[model samples]
Target: MTLSSSLLNAFAPTGTLRASINLGNPVLARRTDSAEPGGVSVDLARELASRLGVPVSFTSFERAAESVAAVTNEDADIGFFAIDPLRGAGIAFSAAYVLIEGCYLVRDASPVTRNEDVDREGNRIMVGTGSAYDLFLTREIKKAQIVRTALSEKVVDAFLRENIEVAAGVRQQLEADAARTSGLRLLDGRFMVIQQAMGMPKARGDEAAQYLREFVEDVKRSGFVADALARYGIEGASVAPATPV
Candidate 1:
């Protein structure tokens, strides 16, 4: 797609695409051995920059909320995030490029054997503040109380420290935590599915957002997204459906 000068400027105001890299969500990003953020989101950022014919640079943040703030504050040109109504107020989203399952982890001896069992009145759930799992549970879970940690990666530790009934997060994260920490097991099935998408500041206008939407759809249909996931050896994330014509 050929972007007009205005669109190009809107998407890359600094003449380079500044992508807010959220290293918090392990499902989408991770710190490589070199300590730089890598994974599916990084691949998407590089591809977007290449298609725009601009250099790509990353502004790393430890939390998803920080990434959203960078874009809305115009500190960064774009970001990867879960598509949600609350965040959509300031950020315009592309079609989702991937789907991530959100699950709960509990003590091995806990009575909550299934995902549905964790939502009881007395149950306390720990989550990462402002995460897609946090937002979804905040809206959907009426009985369970949500206790939040500063970052998603800290949720498991917080759960253990606080002795919370359950820790809620991306399934892969919960799995890794369970594997490393004894006496914890992930509940079968998932409570939510996060739709991961690229977003720009709403101030950039609908035309720029539309272009990103088209770019995402093109990547999904062309297998670019699938290839990225495969290249990164990322599991438990499925490519989102094509945008309907």
Candidate 2:
């Protein structure tokens, strides 16, 4: 796709596109065995840069919030983020390119067998600080207490150490955590599906955002997203349908 010169300039004011890559979200990205960053988000960023005819540089962050902050502050030209109203204040989002399941984990002996059973009054849920799960649970969980940890990868450890009743995170992470640590079971179904999208600073203007939206739809329809997921051996994440702007 040939992006207009104006749109190209809007998305990459620094000449090279600096894409903020969040390594903390295993569902979106992770460091491979050789310590190279690889995942759906990485592929998308490269593809975006390719379309713009610009060189891409990656700014790696350990958490999603950090990635969002980079884009918001214009420290990075773009980032992959879970679309949320709170974050929308500074970032302009494309239609979501991926949907990842969010679920709960609890001790096998715990009485919570179903997804709905988690929001009850005495249950204390541990979530990654500033994650989509933490944001969602903060709004939806009226009765349950929320305990936040520094990283999504540490939610399981926090839960175990604090003896929290439930741990909330990406299903893929929670499933792996449940497997390595005995006696922890995932809730029957997912509580939420996080919408992962590409975003640039809102100051970049609407035209750039529109170009990004189109880029995302083309990537999904062109099979790049599915191919990327399969290439990474990722499971439980589905390509999101294009949403009209």
> Compared with the true structure, what per-residue lDDT tens digits does model 2 show for residues 1-245?
56688887898887999999888799889887754588889889999888889999888888888888999999999999888999999999888999999999999899999988988999999998889888888999988899999888889999999999999999999999998999999988899999999999999898988888888999999999999999989999999986776
Backbone clash numbers for all candidates listed: 0, 0
Model 1 TM-score, all chains together: 0.96
Those runs of model 1 whose alpha carbons end farther than 4 Å from true positions after fitting are: 33-36
Q: Which ten residues in a row have the lowest lDDT in candidate 2?
A: 30-39
Ten consecutive residues with minimal summed lDDT in candidate 1?
Answer: 27-36
Predicted candidate 1 versus true structure: per-residue lDDT over 1-245, tens digit per residue: 57699988988988999999999988778887775579889888998899899998888899899999999899999999999999998999998999999989999899999887888899999998999988899999888898999999989999999989999999888888888989989888888999999999999998888888988999999999899888888899999998862
Alpha-carbon lDDT, every model: 0.90, 0.90
The clash number for model 1 is: 0
